[model samples]
Target: MKKRFWIAIPIMAFGLGWPLLAQENPTEPQPQHAQAQAQPAVSAPDVKSPGTPQLDAADLEAWLDGYMSGALEQGDVAGAVVSVVKDGRPLFAKGYGYRDVASKLPMDAAQTLVRIGSTSKLFTWTAVMQLVEQGKLDLDADVNTYLDFTIPERDGGPVTMNDLMTHRGGFEEGLKEILITDPAKFITTEKYLKDHMRPRIFPVGKVPAYSNYGTALAGYIVERLSGEPFDDYIERHILGPLHMERSTFRQPLPEKFQDNVSLGYMSASQPPQAFEMITSAPAGSMSATADDMANFMIAHLQQGRFGDARILKAETARLMYQPSAPHEPGFTTMAHGFFSGPINGKRLIGHGGDTIWFHTDMNLIPEEGVGFFVSFNSRGKNEAVYGMRERFVEGFMDRYFPDKGNEPLPPAIQSAQADAQALAGKYRSSRRIDTAFLKLIYTLQQSTVIANEDGTISFASEPGTKYRETAPGMWRDPNSEGALHVSTVDGQLTITNSKNPVSDMQRVPLAESAGLNSFILFGSIAVILLALVAWPLSWWCRRLYGQTLGLTGRDLVAYRLSRLLMVGDMIYLLGWYMALQPLFQMQFDGFGTALDPLLFTLQAGALVPLIGVGVGLWNAWLTVRSDRHVMAKAGSVLFAAALCGVAWVAFIGGLMSFTLEY
Candidate 1:
């Protein structure tokens, strides 16, 4: 019974948790596989070099208007605030469309408060660095040293502050209670951290999975060390010093600031939605204007000083922008908190954020003394916000830093047949769940890397796109200059896009891929539903014709049990699916209580279908031995196999677990 329970739990859990199970195993031994490329260097742009610029103010504005205005009109986004700072001064800052469409209130770049999502991590990282500068914290020291609670150490080692900053802490992703709708549900940082500490999955300092829990932990540590609340610490040291008077981390907008807060919308045409409350406040709960964000950007671009106020020494500011961990050899790595990537030959550091309704991006070209910030008030479909950001940044760089004929690309390798074939497999993103139903979503999003006949690799997720060998282990898109580096990390083949290392995906074992499993799962469900309808309809027709089911021994029992198991499994699947609908609806206040019974029912009910595996075989064997119709024998055998596949797939997907730990 205990074994049966263990098996039953994950069948449903895997339905959602398969992708999470594919997350990197931190404790797994790292093999000494020789990598193909030298470590990529961080190119420090000439800070004082007047970079070549072919665009005047008019050209820049015209290009931006064309892109932003059209995107706002097409996407579900209602309004946006854009700001560009060059040489520590605003080159352009303005609002597009209306913040409150019903009231027809136009956005004010400097006054409208918009939730900046994970870009709030910049403030948290900035606080940690400030503490480091003041000798209150150590970057390499065990983070547990400053925390009231211990972050369980894995084989890699105790996670240091630097690991948290670089998102290498190896903490499993937690989403169940991360985003809540009610303000009352928002607990203090101390309580929230203690209650929601996630499992440490990967070995410390190895996997580059972005961890909101790790960042929030950093914030809690700041709260402990500074002897101030996390919200107060930022206000006193960072926001106050920079005079970002309108910016805040507080939920439930303060009385004076309420009128200025923009209504968050799900779509440009839909009615406004409730303001979001992220339980991990430090990781993402920031509300600030474009003008306020510009000040924060200027402080970093100027090496920690905004006008007369300084947040950090010039050296500390530089350290904050430096890469923290290099996951792939010769690939741009994650900086302290910012993601390091290249845009048109320039090395830049930045962060992007999104809540349910708002999308925000803040980027800085440290060498050019330039920064860009943009925020949208509505949660748009089609990813228009992200598309706009990518285009704007690339356009800005192309116009300002016109590429003069530069270094020649490494000669294209004529042969990479073996390597490309070896790389052809399914890869899962590290930023996924290992314990929750949300893993199902990630599983569907897994990318298939296919080795083409032309000695190039294509990704199923990005159709009509192929990456060809430019150098050993390096592949470049023929249509675009973007590149990808393929190498073995932690004994697994990994790929990192030139755009963002944080979005890298690692290859997984063949058995772990969900393609075959998902196909079987859906196929078996369809077979069962068909059998249910056919068996009854055939029985009714036979009764009318005065015919009957022959066989009154184990064959009859086997047939009855087979149908029962199929129906039982269907109920389990449909039950869990219905229970999960509210989870996706953003109404999560009573999720745990609501999910408990469904989990319990599924756990016990899963064993009912396990019996079908055997009964199905018995029925198939009997039909094959008897003078039954060929279709009947074949259907019996196929149905049994489908039953076994469904259960096995469920188990592998992490749906078999009995616990509510997720």
Candidate 2:
């Protein structure tokens, strides 16, 4: 039920026939050493000029500031700083709201230090690209050859550097806890390979799985080949060249800098917690100011040039922007980045970052020679970030690329009732293991089902049945279908079928607990059938034969049933123990013999009651057949006591709480 919402913005220029304007003044004077300068000296835009450019600057600043204010008011951010540049020049830069609510400290453009999160990956990529240009490292070479230790093979083939860079390595599928708590236990790229060598989720280069571990490995490889620590190498090569003095990779804040760093907030309920410096620093652990990030974006916008200093050859910069693989249609995937896509019709490139307590976005409109960077110091609604970015982008394009017309909006959903009714239906799909085990069907209703599909569907008020589309060709019946299992790949739909042989079934009639109800019904039927068969057999035998001889059948049947039930109980106990084994082992003074009491209680407690119940019933049958009133009464009392004891013990031990509904 926990869904991570990622705002995927199409970096295409809005509106058709929009004219792209270049920001760099052709008639402006230039210094003799400008071409050789490594960092550009930034200055505020000249707003007093009587020209179209001046009007554009005012519109751009107002648009950006308005969105920032709206975002803060919506409780989607504690504070934010935004910087916009045109042709490697600072057009507008400002900060809004309190960085630390408890201290009542307002964020300022010069002082605020925002965590850029995965935007740090761009610097790492730039460093690696520098190495590639120097001919010191090969992108396609086997990465294990340069590692301090050996990288184990997956199905006898080593994962290449390209695989790591593109996230094609197959070691990303396991549980993250194995690495989160004690990273050193699985730190090295070589150790990770050795541990997960033979297991592969997908074939190399077949699919792109966004992997944090794989990126970390790439960082390690960069460090090893350069004979320097990863952070040190980046600081020396990339940051130093760009003159990003305040930027650092997980460095402890100095007393002077502490006041400058933003206090990142999550939801309003709890106070903000200090962000942890991750061991996997390469993926997303760098911190910087809006000015520093704006400079970085300017470098990219100018095609690897900052003022006169060229960090990379123009050809190399072009290669970085070139499509590395197929992404969504009309969009292209760059080297670990996103490139331009068809929106209205213009070209744009950008990336968004979401780390704990922060959301950031960096975008560049190359044709217009305009770029922008926005960072929020809060874990707020992702939709707010996306909406703000879209509005800013749209306003900028209208000013700079006015020739392009506005993009057409998709048709809106008018009637909720009509929409819900059209989406209800039966859906099915096969599982990887068993094709027949996965057929799923759902009955639908408006109150019972919440439609998750994008398109319109009809809804019925009475007996409330509605149809909801999860994807094209996939629909869920609101009356019968509870939670429909659906997947979308490039707008194509795949629905899970529960009736299939290998399926993991989903509940229909959305509000009902179908699986738990089925289990209870099956258990009740089994208990009744056992008693029914035992009672009839016991009576027939006593009537035809003597009491002692006739009781053998009942005794044998009871013995088998008790053993079966006890085995089932033991299996359940073992599973529970294994799940909590990590916690027990982690606790103080608990060693190998710690689980003994738990094991014994489950075994003895479950077995004794079932055995006692069977014995008492058998004895009562014999007494009744012999016309012994006293013996029959005693047997009945014993049976009642055993049942009561079983229920009492189960309740006290917290087992009965499992059956209770929330």
Weakest lDDT window of 10 consecutive positions for candidate 2: 11-20
Model 2, 20-39: lDDT tens digits are: 11122234221122332345
TM-score for every candidate vs. truth? Answer: 0.88, 0.58
Tell me the spans in candidate 2 whose CA falls farther than 4 Å from its real position: 1-56, 149-158, 171-199, 251-256, 327-329, 336-340, 381-662
Q: Which whole-number lDDT from 0 to 100 does residue 4 have in model 2? A: 11
- CA RMSD, predictions in order: 10.9, 13.4
lDDT of each: 0.72, 0.49
